[model samples]
Target: MSWSLKIFNKFPINLSSSIHARAFNSKAIGILGVPFDKGAGTRGTDKGPNALREAGLIDEIKHISSNIDVKDYGDVHYELMNTNGRKIHNLNDLSDVAACNKALADQVEKIIKDNRMPITLGGCHSIAIGSISGVLRTTTPDNLCILWVDAHLDLNTNTTSPTGNMHGMPASLLVKELRSNWPTIPELEWCKADLSLRNFCWIGLRSIDYYERIMMEQYGIKYFDMRDIDRMGIDKVTNAALKAINPNGDRQLHVSFDIDSLDPLFANSTGTPAGAGLTLRECLFLMEEVHRSGTLSSMDLVEVNPLVGDVRDVTNTLNSAKAIVCAAIGSNRSGNSS
Candidate 1:
């Protein structure tokens, strides 16, 4: 089962063509794949990056426009941490998670230094610990805002998390508000708590843990769950989210997009499938809006495990992921100017 990429000629969301014309750039994009999945309990998410690539993702992105410069930086590499007799309670594979994220952070920064927008393909949501950290290195938390699109708040600490999967705890690792929640884990010393929770906003959160909800309330974090979308609608909801996080519209924007944000009907291959998630068009519109912002610094598209479902399921998930990437890179449904 294979998939084809197509941009509709009549996209209903008219954010204005002038904006797209001015916003569209010969943007140089660097593709970096973090194939490390130690942060997740699932075994196959590490193959996500290559799965999309093998499905003609890069070629399709290149076909978006002649001016679009896309470079494949290839996959990130890291040393596997040997935890000989060392273990962290309730934190699964801390050593490997730390080791891989450290390397990922380094590469993300390098991509930025080269003036290419970093487009990261992830092993899981935990890869965000590195992607977000790398973006933080170039700008201050005050000047950066992360728009996290997922089914979960991802705000749990090791002790608060029922499952020790580091994927569930990346947000806590990077947020300053949750700094007190974590105990000293020597393996993760390189990863710091830098970004504040206020700098983060979430979308498509329908499956939040108890502790995560408590933390969200305590921090007054702004989020638009599926219920909110069901009310205000995706367009208005997306605009509100942009205004909330980047009110001034000048901050560096980093979007951590988890495929599980989409309903299982569209993305059933992911390890975590939340029902009544965003539709494929809705997710595409969000990416389109992100591109229109022109402040998109980097993005992490994660959690499409090819090994989790049947052939058709894997193909659908990959195609959805590829379409989102294309839209982010300036492929308009109204068609590109070039």
Candidate 2:
């Protein structure tokens, strides 16, 4: 059973009108496929990017934003070593992850330096490190902001992670990791310390570990947990997130969206499905609000594990992809000036 990309091609958007000028620049959006799943506690997320691609994400995004110039950069290269014919906790694999991410960071740095937005599709949630870090390298220190959308805090360090899963450590790597092994590559110089803690914000957190919580609080990183979401509502939550990234709405913003943030009922196929999470409609509303924020400089969709999924898994994944496209490309016409 091969995947199909035709499902998304039928809705080509028309950019002949002036309503969506910013989204039409053919040189604006770049797509990359990072197919590594070493970060998750479970396996099989490596097939996520190709699965989404075959699901017709490219043409669907284009149709939604007719003038968008989206290009596919293909998948990052990797070699996995199996222990006794089964994959297990091997910190040695971090080197391969670093190499692939360093390359990805270089690509993203170039895209940002060229003034284009990058939309990265992931193999697992851990890939956000390379993708986001790559873009930060090209930007000024004060101009960087990262909005992490996920159900987990993802702030575990190598020492604190319960499962030794790298996905749990990307947030910690961003802030606390010493970078002794993952030194600055030529393609990703700006990524070193430029992506400071001041540029970070967390939304939709519910499954936080004690250590992760302590790390976040110690660093004073702003986070809106699910309780906050219920109180402030999705619209306000998104506004607060955008505001955190670019308070005055001047600098560029990057959104790292983890699929597991949605309720298991909505996104059951993700590697780590957190129970009490955002509803599908709430996720769409948040995306739409972000679309209107104007500072959506870069985006990433991560952690869609398809191997353990049921029949409805791909369908639900497709819906989430559509929400992302709509948020990135769809414009608010309610108050536009003619």
Candidate 3:
């Protein structure tokens, strides 16, 4: 890498522009908005990326430092047709969902090629299959670690899902061979499906179906449930998650934080809210921990729906979102900088 493109390069910010498409002027942070919500069986989450951006996240990121280049790539475009004629267990209009995810993967791959950290603002948790696949394609398979922070296990496949929601499938797809289930979906096979299950970890989980639980145990994916959190404390649990996700591996880290991981009171806007979830402070501490780890190569802050809540819900979501981003790029000399 050239000295000018080094991670510490200094860059000025222009408040008004899409941050992902333009050539990064410094150690650029690329922002791509995935606005499709059919994955979640909800209408409002489609507005997530725009709402977060309109909440002045760019300005907040810029406020952190002048050396960081933040670029917005705008939202993924997908035409939503009727749900008629879709496969029985499939939630989304499968064809449309596949097309949209392909676009998402392509954009993410481009951002990674630009040598910038892709900070994706998501419409739903399902976008992970695309974004993570893109990153995993560019990065070595053996060096990939995914940190999934959510209240729900999200391990349901089409065969196990009662609601047939694709949002519940990303975690499983990330760790399993999803192409067999969605055989006709070309996008699901964008990368080789022979990836291992050893590099995944889940935190803040309070909800899990029986089938999902069995899968977690079967794969031996390290998960810190709510009870575990109460017993071990956030500091210890967070460290455990970090250690499990990386596992002495050479791969970089990618964190997928579903805002629904926050308590229902704090994240009422999301479609599926678990009874008890992480508090605002715990979530922030988790983000701070990720920042301190110094291995976070990309991040996705997802599932913020402004349409379902009052100003307070919106305010909490906005504040939580900002706090999480700050945690990811926190100042030096804080926490564990390992």
Clashes of each: 0, 7, 6
Give the residue spans of candidate 1 off by over 4 A: 1-26, 81-84
Which lDDT tens digits does candidate 3 get at residues 180-275? 554444444454554566677778888888888776655555677777777667877776666655644345888899998888776778878887
lDDT of each: 0.84, 0.69, 0.73
All predictions: root-mean-square deviation over Cα? 6.8, 10.0, 10.1
lDDT head-to-head 2 vs 3, winner? 3
What C-alpha lDDT, on a 0 to 100 scale, does residue 89 get in candidate 3? Answer: 48
The lDDT of model 3 is 0.73
Q: Give the clashing pairs for model 1.
A: none
TM-scores for all candidates: the values are 0.92, 0.81, 0.84
Comparing 1 with 2 on TM-score, the higher-scoring candidate is 1
142-189 per-residue lDDT for model 1 (tens digits): 988899999998888989998999999888899888888788877788
Candidate 2 overall lDDT versus native: 0.69
lDDT of 2 by residue, 243-295 (tens): 65566667667788998888888888888888889988787777776666566
Off by over 4 Å in 3: 1-27, 78-88, 177-187, 331-338
